[model samples]
Target: MDTSGFLEWLKASLSSSEKTSDRRILRFVHPDDDKRFLRSLRAERPGSKPLRGIRRLGIIRAYSCPVPPEGLPVSFGGAIVWEEDIRVSTHAILAAQRVPADSGIPWGVRRIRAPEAWSRTTGHRVRVGVIDTGVDFDHPDLRHSLERGINLLQRTALPHDDNGHGTHIAGTIAAANRMQGMIGVAPRSAIYPIKAFDYNGTAYVSDIILGIDWCVRNRMDVVNMSFGMSTRSKSLLNAVSNAYRSGVLIVASSGNDGKRGRIDYPAKYPQTVAVGAINRKGEIASFTNRSDSVDIYAPGERVDSCWLRGNRKTMSGTSMATSHVTGAVALLLAHKPGLTPEQVKTVLKRSKRPLRNAKAPRKTGELDIARMLQVADKLM
Candidate 1:
């Protein structure tokens, strides 16, 4: 049987006495065939039912199962791949990577030339889904654009923010550019916060996958992932593929591990745009992970944006950088709702401004939101 079928069987028969060492998630080539697959699994293996079903995405129905001492079968009767579930952490390194900000409008805002782009579109018709902890809807800057959110942590439909990280990310992407405080890249865009992480800023692979599934089912135009994990998960690949194939542009943080290692998984995945961090001087931050998968760089060091309690805070991480691209993409999509993930990527990559970064060669360039908008306008 395939890994999905095997896992479905394993989840049903699991007991304290079973000493299985496998930790695998399985996916079917045709996600729409889930019902048929499940029925076949039941017929082939008696007394088995999956613990639960994740069906909203229409690309995967993952099940967790143990690995027998011997090993996973080379192949199931049907097509399937065994995948591992890896924990994904908020990419923020806290104050450790924070750099001193020079006196001026937030460098990130000025660097991308967001004010000029605003004249064209504030992402009015675009819908963005943030897959993070949650957003603080009470924050004045974020209150209007933030719609109802799903708290995957508690499995509730509540607008909540436990770790404050998600709120910060949301503010970067859609905080209404009110005169009083910090503004976002796409101020008028709609934000859907999917709380996948908990108070500790840690989430299981399952949580992130479910969040992506939700985004796909809801028809999100853009999905922002400000987190990273080193290991790759087949389940995640399937989810991302589903979203991309369905016309959602997924953006993720390249990671904060610096020269120590490669870009983190999900970001490293081809379907998502991997963004790195840049300092105020338009140079890559030493902490931003340098890897071939990094598709672009954005202002992330000491970047000022909205925080919890209707406050503004300065944070530094590839996570913050990712929201810049997320909002930028939103603006593009708002101007042209039919922009495919590939077309949006081409415009952003082609319109990037040249930058001098000795340490990170993958830092394609800094975001030029205005130019991107102009190109998108012409294309549309």
Candidate 2:
């Protein structure tokens, strides 16, 4: 409900001119209110017109109007709240980290104990929705696990990765067949690419909400969001809440700001599993964000996975760590498809491997996917 960020930005932009000419964007309480408010604003302030808008769990509407210079338009009375729509990529430096062990599998794969997990379910029945830029549906390592997708930016059915970030995240979650020298934690899980970010890896909160809405409508088992923003958004929280209520497990990156302060939105929201990064040494990554909201740590430093153009590359970030946990969730869900979001969290917390040097209990250790599967089997 914090509309302060949006209001502050509007005030600064309006200060440049006595009467601003640009459209002011806002999230309304309802669709009917958005229509009625825009009609009233135009009637009272002439020349004001409604611009682009989208309605999901919340109503997002924008309008072009002349500022009064004295105060905000009366039409904005209760329809106004802080719009925390601006979100940035949580990816850290993109360089390869050398692995000491010569295990044929990627170090991250080994770090999460994924090979042992393969003996059980390989995540065959789970569907993970990657709400990032998009995925490379043709990449050899990911193509087999890739399923249908929707592009929110272009309003299309195919959501392809142009930024390469989404492909990396997707590959980490469900790469299959050891193709192109890579294997994901949940190799057999289906990945549904929900393209919310653009080529620059930038996404708005509204776009993310739309993507989550799509996932809920499609009944996706889990959603992986490897991005973060500093602000708390109402619409984003509403979308996440609705998704969780609908039985979808959500995972997100704590952030890569390297700060000990609060983590990012949606992840900070209690319903999400906020993940931080650990390096090859099993120590917290130097760039990983720390906070109570972070639920677990995973291998993220210099991790290699599928990339654009059927190639592979090493990247580091809580984004990569988030993908590992997403795959782990798929593995658990494949065995126990009826588990609720709270049940999934409990299993993950119960099966976590303790880290000797972890700063706190929250970042105590990495995910033990094999152990998680064993626990799931016992529960069944």
Each model's C-alpha lDDT? 0.77, 0.76
> Against the true structure, candidate 2 has what lDDT?
0.76
Q: Model 2 segments beyond 4 Å from truth?
A: 1-72, 79-84, 95-104, 358-363
List the lowest-lDDT window of 10 residues for candidate 1: 95-104
Clashes of 1: 2
Write candidate 2's Cα lDDT for 21-70 as tens digits: 42222555666655665454444333312212222333224432223434
lDDT: which candidate is best?
1
Instruction: Give the per-residue lDDT digits (tens) of candidate 1, residues 202-319.
Output: 8877777788888888889999999988887777887898889999879999888885458988898889998989888888898999766788889898877766666667788999
**Among these predicted structures, which one has the highest TM-score?**
1
Error of 1 at 224 (Å): 0.2
Residue 183: error of model 2 in Å? Answer: 1.3
